[model samples]
Target: MMRIWPVFRRELVGYFATPLAYVFIVIFLFAMGASTFYLGNFYEGRTANLERFFLFHPWLYLFLMPALAMRLWAEEKKTGTIEILMTLPIPAWASVMGKFLAAWAFSGIALALTFPMWITVNILGEPDNGVILASYIGSFFMAGGYLAIGSCLSAATNNQVIAFVVSIVVCFLFTVSGLPLVLQVAQAVLPTPVVSAIASFSFLTRFEAIAEGVIDLRDVIYFASLILLWLGINVALLERARAG
Candidate 1:
């Protein structure tokens, strides 16, 4: 736990040491503002619901989360730091957990910065705070799931660009699985149950429930399990790489 704290502190500080964190926050604010205010027609339509903001998240995270996670292990491997890192007395799982938590917390900060939108909604109309809070919780867990996948992919390669591209592709597949385009394609050939099962695995399917203010236990479990599954895979990959 002590070793984990040092790595977490280092990675958290590392995020602020570069322009990456600033750039990400700025772009994220712009994207959220544009989506909710201009494109979402929140002002003109005067909708109290946060559908517009939540709608844009999967696509936004599909790109931005990968950028945040691309350097996790890829940069270490590329600079020969992984060799030295492995020599430390830290358990592999602790290192993976520490780094993953740091990145997840960083992403959570970016998500929290969008709170102004929630404030705006409350000021404009009688927004349901309960639902809004649930939605925020859902978004945070979803981002963690995406980050776990990105961390795993980053660990598998030394090139940041390759890691970024691969993470984006994998995340994209998860995001689009339940969309009409993908479901339509699946329905054309697969049986009804199979198609339904495929769509059920989508990120959208799980998130949409929370976006609607229904904090179902099953949905929470699904996202938590998704995060843990990928993190376990990440640990295994890093361990294998170190051994090899």
Candidate 2:
């Protein structure tokens, strides 16, 4: 835990040391606002729920989170600093957890900056603040899920673009897994129970539960386990890369 902090601090500071982090934050803020008002029809809805605002999060993170995570290990490998990082006294798991937490914190910052949307909903009328809070929590976990997937892909290659593209594709599959059309296709080839289980793995399904203020233990566990699983894979892959 103590060791993780140094890596976390280093990586977090590294983000702002360049224009990449600033550019990402600016675009992310703009996109969230544009999506809330334009695509979300915030004014037309006339509702104070902020449901329209949170609705686009999974899709938004599909691209944005990958861009944030693509450089996690890709930049390290590209510059051949990965060896230096690995040879440090810290455990690989600590480094892995630290890097992931750094990216996740950065994502949380972007999400938190959208507080204006929340404030607008409050100003408009009465709203379920509980549901809004729950949605924010769910959105953070969803972003973690996206980042974990991107981290694994980034570790697999030294190309940030490849990491971004592949993360989008994989995240898209998880996003659509619970859709009616996708479920229908799965049902045709799989048993009823199998189809149900597969749909349970969908990020949208888990996120929607919390978005509605459910906060089920199962939903939280799914995302927590996902982050752990993929990040474990990330550490193992990095070790293999180091050995080679």
Candidate 3:
């Protein structure tokens, strides 16, 4: 943890040192507001809950997470700073975890900025704040999953654009794995157990389960495992890069 702190702090502070952080925050907040109020019809629903607001989180993170992750290692490699990073005394795993955690925290900040939606719902009517809080937790985990995937993909390539596009495509597959359309396709070529496994990996499914107010241990474990798996791969990719 001590070895990771400097890298984490450097990466996190680097975000606010530029306009990228502000731009991302503004875009994220606006997108959340528009999706919640206009696209989701929060007022027309007449429900006090933030179901509409939380519902859009996965889809929103689809684009936003990749955009954030594309720069993690891609920009470093492109600018040739990755060599400097590689020379640091920190272990590769610590660097990878530090960078991933920094990006995840940045995303959490953006997510937290949407608290007004929660405030608005409370002012309008009594709602299950517990369920809402659970949904927030689920959304944050889901974002971490996306960022982890993107982080690995970013490390795999020097082109940020390729990293962004590939990250989106991979994240899309994970997001839709539980849907009938994807499951149907998988079931055709695969056995029942395999199909079931594919469905279990769906970000939407796990998140929706938690959003329903049940923070099932399985759901938490699933997200944690997914993040760790991808981060492990991310470290391997960086190790390979250093070797080459």
Candidate 2 vs 3: which has more TM-score: 3
Superior by lDDT: candidate 1 or candidate 3: 3
Clashes of each: 0, 0, 0
Clashing pairs in 2: none
* Cα lDDT for residue 60, candidate 3: 95
C-alpha lDDT of all candidate models, in order: 0.90, 0.92, 0.95
Off by over 4 Å in 1: none
Q: Please give the lDDT score at residue 41 for candidate 2.
A: 89
TM-score of 1: 0.96
Report the C-alpha lDDT of model 1 over 1-244, residue by residue, as the tens digit.
7889988888989999999899999998898888777777777776787888888888889998999999999999999988877888988888888899999999999999998888888888898889989999999989998999999999999999999999999999988899999999999999999999888779998899888999999988988898889989999998798678
Q: Between which residue pairs do clashes occur in model 1? A: none
Name model 2 segments beyond 4 Å from true. none
Give candidate 2's root-mean-square deviation (CA, Å): 1.0
In angstroms, how far off is 80's CA in candidate 1? 1.2
